[model samples]
Target chain A: MSKLCFVTTGATAPFTALIEAILSRPSLDALLECHVTHAFVQYGTAKDVYETSAKAAREYLRQQGKETQLEIDGMDFDSSGLREQFKLVQDTKGLVVSHAGSGSILEALRFQVPLIVVPNTVLLDNHQEELAMAMDRQNYLIHGNISNLAPAIKASEEFRNKMSQFPPVTAGKERQTKSFARIMDETVGFTDFNNE
Target chain B: MLPACPALYTTTFLLATLATLLVAATLRLLTILPHTRSTPPPPRRRPGTLTRVLIVLGSGGHTHEMLALLRDLDPRRYTHRTWVVSSGDAFSASRAVAFETALAEKASRDTGEGKEEAGRWHVGPQYYTVVEIPRARRVHQSLLTTPVSAVHTLLRSLTLLYRSEGLPDLILTNGPGTACIVVLAVLVLKFFDLRGAQSRGKCKTVYVESFARVRGLSFSGKLVGRFVDRLVVQWEGLEGVSGGRAEYWGVLV
Candidate 1:
């Protein structure tokens, strides 16, 4: 099986700009040739709009005599199913392009997948952009806008290398979990109780 | 001349009253003086026991943060865990269930036993219960109706708590509007018990302010600040602003 690339826009918002940029002819040709054998795009709360865009992209690809290899969903996958998809990403040594929501970024990072984060500009407060930039600064991922989608994909080679040095997000979770347990033990007076 | 017996009785009574007054004043001063000293005695230690922990999860970011904290808690230490969320938040509920499943899988993996033993771990309800109550204030809900919704939520929370096998030993929250109702429910129960009613186990509240609140406390954090057993802020600067009640615990998320 060919390598996979997963793209998601979270559950609540639409990132059509990211979707459009990724499905643009040049990006598709580059991805098909150099990167992924299959692509899964989860459009999230903007199903109808994304479906229309996906149809147009497919038609354009067919007219250009290029084989279509994209699977698009209007919304997110089921919880269990999404977990399996992440597992696929890990298994295939694939990449992820995601909106800069903390949950999405962290989940992708947990699998140690090379990531490209495009902040949805429509979001309030520029929070997503800030998060994306910070992660980029740490060399954990490539941060870009929809305008520079192809270059960000090109940067994935560097991102994959940087990922080896970057610690798995699960390590942080495990450490925090241990500290939290200790706090609970101390707070609840369980230390002495456990000894007995 | 007055009768000698009457005069003697009157004098004895006067002297006794004066002596009693002086002794009472001295005792009061003795008790009050110790507190006036600069250094206070260390707080008494509470007896620790396996606790029932109730974790309140808000949608999205709040739920994610709480999950990270929960992952760190030793499951054996908290014999019973209950997750509370607002009604209509199916995402949080699903995530809670998924986390429990993953935990069970991890436990089985650690045992390194046969399939039969792993099946044993999977048997029975996992260590947690998810309880959903009406939101205190729905998005775009009328301000006038908010109190009604809040009261409804409090009543539901109280019932949920009462129906549980035992009162929660502790309640953990991370700045959600729904948490206010749960905290209120606990306080209301405590209030009734205080008035010579049936005793419910003392349920302590620990509110961890979200890490995003760098400059100030969120509205829910501010509301529960005075009431929670511990107000934990992740940022050091917040301690000064929280009237010294908020303890800086470093970043939890």
Candidate 2:
């Protein structure tokens, strides 16, 4: 089984750009040898378009004499099944190539997985880009555009080394919460009524 | 200044007094005879007892930030915790569950206990509950039906608070449309004695502005910003902009 997993969970919009970029890579044959499981969620994409795209990708693979190992999904899977999908990412223990959604980034970070974030510029706000850049600044993940997907993947080994030394990103430290609680105590007398 | 006509002044004064009295009487009646019958108050907790807390979870970034805020809350201090999420927002619900699970695991690990009981379903000493209520308004949804949905959600939130074994002492939220309705419902419940005598101390509402809104307040934040007991902004720059209502909390998430 290939350890590398490429996830494109574009719940609000289809990330066809990411999928096409991954499939059209010249080094598809090299990746095939790694047995990479290219799991792509074509969320919000029309069924016909997805099918046509997948079929074309498969034909391209056939022409290149490369075996296809692609798991493509439509928009059926949503937030409800996020944990289950994240389990797949963890099980793979490979590099994660994902769209720059906070939820996705957090999940990948939770597992300390080497990640390459590709921001979808088509979104109304550039918030994803911001999140990606911030995470990149933290050395948590490689933030790359779709066009740079190949280089991003190639840099995963180095990214993984950095991730290994980095402590897992938890929700926040206990001190932060304790401080907030103290403020709550003084402002709202939160602890006053609790005494019994 | 004296009115030009004494008769006109007298008539206007009389009418105003009558209207004021009528409104006051109506308000008193509403409180005294609420439509929903109040439940009996729970046994009063002695001083230093556990405080029941209700936290609202908004989807995506809000949920992420809230989880961060909750990460260090002393489980021993807050023994009872209820999480409320908007309907159809399984993402937030799942994140809440995951957070609780992580917290429980960490507690067990810290105490060097539950090692033998690992892999078994072990209910910890803490109490955590997750409840879902309808969304006040759906995105891209028609505004015409927003009032109906908002009212429906408010009613559901009211019922949830009323039915809970104990009413929450504090309600915390990061503003989204759903939090607005939930806060309103809680305020109404407090005013009407819908949650029984245990609701004596009005549940303190805390609204934390989303980290994304560094320059300005979100629409939902703007709506309930003033009404909440405490309005928190992560950025120091927002302090002046919020007219001193928003306390700078630094980066929470």
Q: Give the per-residue lDDT digits (tens) of candidate 2, residues A69-172.
A: 74444444464535555566667766667777665666566677778888888877775786677667768789877775666766776677776322332346
Native contacts conserved, per model: 0.15, 0.08
Weakest 10 consecutive residues of candidate 2 chain B by summed lDDT: B33-42
Which portions of model 1 show Cα errors greater than 4 Å? Answer: A14-17, A25-34, A62-65, A68-76, A146-148, A163-178, A192-196, B1-50, B97-123, B126-128, B162-164, B187-201, B209-219, B222-227, B231-253
Considering every candidate listed, which one attains the maximal DockQ?
1
Model 1's TM-score against the true structure: 0.71
Best by lDDT: 1
| TM-score of each prediction | 0.71, 0.65
lDDT tens string, model 1, B1-253?
A: 6647988979988999999998976664443221211223223333323457898999787888788777755454565778898999998898887877777666656554543311233312556888899999987899999999999999999898877877877789997799988987877666555322124334767788875565678789988786666677765568745556776655555
DockQ of each: 0.15, 0.14
Candidate 2: regions farther than 4 A off: A10-17, A26-51, A65-93, A146-196, B1-7, B14-48, B59-76, B87-132, B151-166, B185-201, B211-216, B232-241, B244-253
Poorest stretch of ten by lDDT in candidate 1 chain B? B33-42
Instruction: Give the docking tier of candidate 1.
Output: incorrect
Using TM-score as the measure, which candidate wins? 1
